[model samples]
Target chain A: MDDTTARHTEKMRRIKAARDEMMKTKTEEKGLIIVNTGKGKGKSSAGFGMIMRCIAHQMPCAVVQFIKGARATGEATFLRERFVDECRLFVTGEGFTWETQDRDRDIAAAQNGWEIAKAQILDPDIQFVLLDEINIALRNDYLDIDEVVDFLLTQKPHMTHVCLTGRNAKPELIEAADLVTEMTLLKHPFRDGVKAQKGVEF
Target chain B: MDDTTARHTEKMRRIKAARDEMMKTKTEEKGLIIVNTGKGKGKSSAGFGMIMRCIAHQMPCAVVQFIKGARATGEATFLRERFVDECRLFVTGEGFTWETQDRDRDIAAAQNGWEIAKAQILDPDIQFVLLDEINIALRNDYLDIDEVVDFLLTQKPHMTHVCLTGRNAKPELIEAADLVTEMTLLKHPFRDGVKAQKGVEF
Candidate 1:
């Protein structure tokens, strides 16, 4: 074989090898977890992307936003109305923890959300779970980080993927996560005294 | 009557209103396609629980399985491997087109294998495209269907999801797919006598 032909043959060999690996990798379920943190926008947005991917593939998923509390955002409104039956889209909200003032009540609400989340995470029907703003809740003691990590690890071998988002992710949580992505904040409209943009921030 | 209780009540109302409309409709992008038909099981198993739910969350999803891919099995393996990436998986493969066959190729070969499959359906980054069984080489006029579909569609929105798998799916081409799933039948070990398992065959 000449140069091009030789290259083509070599490429084919590599391709077959890779295909074999892929087949092997795909045979068993691989669980995943992504922690989206740091002070920035779009953590939840990233989670939303995963949700959409799962729906397109016909996988069942669930989403629970702790601090968000159903804020009438365009995304929540759209998904709740149309795709709920097809996918598991749930928004259990108690509003922002700091704003609520009743620390005990806030903790209780977080616990409640955690319970719901716990059930879904373990449910075999649920392939991916987006815990929107979960990091913040864990930081504030609204939810226990240790418990969350424990559940994640226990569920890991089952092929369940989880995405945890929000600011102030604890060091332990970051270490425990399979993929920890910190969305650094270089600048923001909020810092410029501009209010959160509609369709951008809840 | 105190100020604290009054503020809490107001916040509660706001949260409720936001969530009530969670049932409202939202915008959607172009639909996607998922093909999970094949002699092997787990085609739908792979697609249904991962990428499908992602779209269900308003990511814009459309799934078309050429064969009856949605017979739910108590043991679902394909859908569980999606915790790491959601918007990246799209499934489209029909185990085999029963209607097409010829003596030249008993099983899908290079014409349909790595060659046409690569030329046709393998664009890992494309938003959505699933070629389930372009593997039926000479049987289904290998290379033709794969090339045509690859040439036709536009890959965009960056978050499109697709899935494909099945027996005789061209190897070379299927390799190019962002994600590929193959159901290797193990110990259906049913001796020529036993009936097929229910919830196992869809």
Candidate 2:
């Protein structure tokens, strides 16, 4: 082999050993509070993917999309049509806060959505609950962060996994999260005058 | 309404108008080269999510996982059992390049895997392709980036959407991509002694 390749092979050997050693010590499994936030895209998509992962194992899952996103997103349609046996979806809010045009109106809409989310989250039958875009509600103070976190951490079943997706997640929520991934937008097509397409942006 | 609420609503109204105007100018639809990369957790999940989005529209899809991650992950099993009519999965590689312990062996496996991927990507029947963890192969020189990009951009059909997921994506690949998201790992359960769960990690 070439010189660089031989060196890389040697380096990979060390990394492989380290990873193997680290992996052996981990044997504990618990429900996770996974948060996907930041200004980048893919948060909701990743959350939906996690739901898909659960449905793969025949595990019961639910999705509660807070704020907007109720106008027939691609994921919502797909889930309703294909995985009805394993999944339930709730796309909440009349519109975004801006569209609602009033603070009280926005909160009232979100509170209504939260009632359904609370019931599904606390339901013992559900194993994975994707709190889709609920972060936006929390960020805008439409939902109380402490109350939401308390239910997720102390009230929810030990085996229940929750993934919260949206931008501008609260700092307290991040601190309490077991997994937090920020989807950073490196480049977007809209800047180049391209529009969101079906089966892609939806 | 309160003074603060009135001010915020006014600002939102203006912003909403701008958005409505910008959205109308976009009517183009083309195949996209989407790249998800970074030291984050949701890269693959988001890619899988996009695949799910397509499935929502009943678009044909295929997933080709590179490097490792072929030990019966949840998504792989789920897609195979449930979406046989909509999707196909091809998992390649004996192990990671490190596990292979030989550079040539790694390349051979990657090349073998690429053949399957190229076939699926070029296939007119498929609308979306997820090249799961392929950035690893390109980063390690297991496959040539230029050739891959050329095929994805030129040879592949216009309606075909491809998502390349992994860390350390090449500059050329990123430059050619339509959407690029970096999954920044802010918090991981492994750091706090928690193990990867079945549905969450897989």
Candidate 3:
């Protein structure tokens, strides 16, 4: 074999060996509680993406929107129309906290949303549950972090995955989660005076 | 009006006024150069989500895979099968960097991949272009950062959005980008001894 082919072969062999070694210990499979939080865009977008991933796998999925539920979003509209059979979406929030301006009302709405999410979390048929913007509810003290954690710990079905998305995730929830991603702000067009557009931001 | 109804009405009026004021300033529409980078997962997955968003809008899209192209991924397989008319997926990498090992070959592959990407970026018919893992090629010095930035700045179609996904995005690229999200590592299942599963990781 030529020098290049021989080098590539040797390198791939090393990679395979290392990957095999890593795989040897990676045997556990269980439900994953994934949290997407931080002060940046795409947290909810990523969570929505996971719902699509679930659909691609032919898994039944449910989306429970906590904030930004007063009006329909492009994602909710599209998913409902396109993947009607495989997905169930619940928009339970009255509106954004700032819009509601009533703590008791927000808390009540959050409690109602959590009830929907809890039912999905416990459902064996639903393999992926997206609690979109639920972090904002948790941040606003609309839902008790301890209560949410206890429910997640106790209610999630085996092999089911739950994704929570929003900014300022609670420390307790972060600690309890199996996977967490902090979408850090780098640069945004809003800083440049750009508006949120359909098919992009929503 | 009842006390709670009157309060909610006042709050919603205030919100509508603020929203209208914000909407007044958001008028410009142009293609965005989006960057998803940093040491975290979901960058490429998020990009793929954008591709889906484009597809939902009935817009043509293309994905140019830079690194993880040695094998067929679930995203590629599903998209190719389902959205055959609306999406174009190009897997142009020989393999991951460690698996390839040869600097010269990697550079050549990156150069070739960039050529494909350049064509897609300039295509007016393609509304969304996802450069999957292109940042790794840039980080490895396989493609000249300045050249890539200049091309992105100069040759991009007026209405085509480009999303670059990977870790270690160059400062020059970030400066030129319209939107940037850094996916910070919070917690990962791989660290807890879980293998990359078929539908989830790919």
Candidate 4:
């Protein structure tokens, strides 16, 4: 063999050995409680991507929007219209906090949303549940973190994966999550006076 | 008006005024250079989500994978099988750095992938272009950053939205980007001895 080919083969051998060692310890299979939080875009978008992944796997899923209101997002319209059997969508908020300044009304919306989320979590056929913007509701104290955590711990099916997406995720929720990602804002067009566009932001 | 009704109306009036002011400043429409990079997961997954968004809008799109090998990823499989007319998939890498173990081969792969990506960027029919893991290739010196940036600036269609996803994005790229998100790793299941699952990871 040539020198370059021999060196490459040797390098791959070392990598394979290390990978095998890492793979040996990764044998557990269970549902994941994933949290996507921080001050950046794409948290809910990522959650929606996971729902699409579930659909690709032919697994049923549901989405509950907590603070985005009844306005038709591109995701909501597409998922509801195209994948009816695979997705059950509920847009449960009047709007954002500033848009709906009444705390009592926001609280009632959160409570109503939680009930639907709870039902989806208990449904055996639904393998994936996306609680879109639930973190913001939790951050605003619209929903009790303890109640949410308790239900997530005790009632979720063993193989049912749940993802919560929004900024300011509660520490208690983070502590209970199996995976957490914080989308850090490096730059945003809105800061430079660009508006959110259809299909891109919605 | 009753006390509660009067308060609610006032709150909505304030909200409407703020929204109107914000809307007045957001009138420009152009293509976006979006970057997703960091040490956390979901960079490429989020890019795939954008492809889905484009599909939902009935806009044509293309994805060129730079570091991920020509394996049958769930996103690739589903997109190719279902959205044949809307998506153009190109898997141009043999594998990751360790898997390939040859810098020259890696560079060649990146170059070839960039050619495909360039064509897609200039295609007016394709509204969205996803350069999945191209940032890692650039970080590894598999491709020239200046050439990529210049091409992105000069040749991209007026309305084509391009997304680049990977870790260690170049500073120059971030500066040129319209939107940038850094996915921070808070907790990963791999660190906790959980294996990557089919639907979630692939």
- The numbered model that scores best in TM-score is 2
For candidate 3, write residues A50-70 as lDDT tens digits: 776677777888999998887
Report the TM-score of chain B alone for all candidates: 0.43, 0.92, 0.93, 0.93
A best-first ranking of the candidates according to their TM-score comes to: 2, 4, 3, 1
lDDT of 1 by residue, B68-185 (tens): 2233222222333432233322232222322222222323332333343343334444344333333444234544654544543443233443444345655444434332333333
List model 4 lDDT by residue over A77-168, tens digit each: 77877788888999999888777667788889999999999999999888889999999889978899999999999889988899999999
The fraction of correct interface contacts reproduced by each prediction comes to 0.00, 0.75, 0.46, 0.55
Full candidate order by lDDT, most accurate first: 2, 4, 3, 1
DockQ of 2: 0.66
- lDDT per residue (tens digit) for residues A14-102 in model 2: 99999888988777788889999999989999998899889988889999888755367889888888888899988787667767667
Model 3 native-contact share:
0.46
- The TM-scores, chain A only, for the candidates as listed are 0.82, 0.91, 0.93, 0.94
Candidate 4: list runs displaced more than 4 Å: A1-12, B1-16
**DockQ of all candidate complexes:** 0.04, 0.66, 0.45, 0.54
Better of 1 and 4 by TM-score: 4
Model 3, runs deviating above 4 Å: A1-16, A100-105, B1-23, B102-105
Supply every candidate's count of residue pairs whose N, Cα or C atoms clash at under 3 angstroms: 63, 0, 0, 0
For each candidate in turn, the TM-score is: 0.47, 0.93, 0.89, 0.93
Q: Give the alpha carbon lDDT tens digit for every residue of B87-166 in model 2.
A: 99887866667677788878888898789999998999999999998999999888999999888888889878889999
